[model samples]
Target: MPIEVKNELGKIQVMNEVIATLAGSAALECYGLVGMASRNQFKDGIAELLGRENLRRGVEVRHEKDRTEIDLYIIVSYGTKISVVAQNVQAKVKYVMNEVIGLQVNTVNIFVQGVRVA
Candidate 1:
């Protein structure tokens, strides 16, 4: 589904993939965040880190009513505070989506897929 934004001129529709990529990129910028992780569960129970172009694989975007919801699957650096890092990612994702794309994000949910020493 597309997110619709109405203005005096007309209406703008943002694709769900665009929102997911934006959110994924924003999440990757936060401190202690290693990289975005694919949400697909493997038999080994490990998720591969995703590169920039494939960021959407790790991000899920949905629109409910007038609000946009984002879910991020990420890998964080080992020994970092999970809650603090997650919070920062949430704030940054929300801000970037709102400021850059003119999309107001109602929630940014972070899922810690795994932690790496690096």
Candidate 2:
């Protein structure tokens, strides 16, 4: 479902992909984050890393009446504090969605797919 907003001019619809992109971008900017991870899980239990163009593959957005919830799958650098990285991602995603996209984020959930040495 798209997010609908009405202004003096008319109604605007924000697609899910837009939200996903914003969330993914925000998450990637965090210090410990390596990259976004594709949600598709392999039989060998590995999640593929997604490039910039494929960011939406790592983010899931759900729209409610007044807010949106986001789930982000990411990989972090080895030896970084996982909790701190997750919190940073959550805060950044929430800020971008609210400030840039003008959407209220109800939740930003982070899933750590893997840790890379470099």
Give each model's whole-structure lDDT. Answer: 0.89, 0.88
- Deviation in angstroms for 67 in model 2? 3.6
Relative to the true structure, candidate 1 reaches a TM of 0.94
Best by lDDT: 1
Worst 10 residues of 2 by lDDT: 40-49
Q: How many residue pairs clash in model 1?
A: 0
Could you tell me which residue pairs clash in candidate 2? none
Candidate 1 stretches with Cα past 4 Å from truth are none
What tens digits encode model 2's per-residue C-alpha lDDT throughout 26-60?
Answer: 89899999999998764378778889999999999
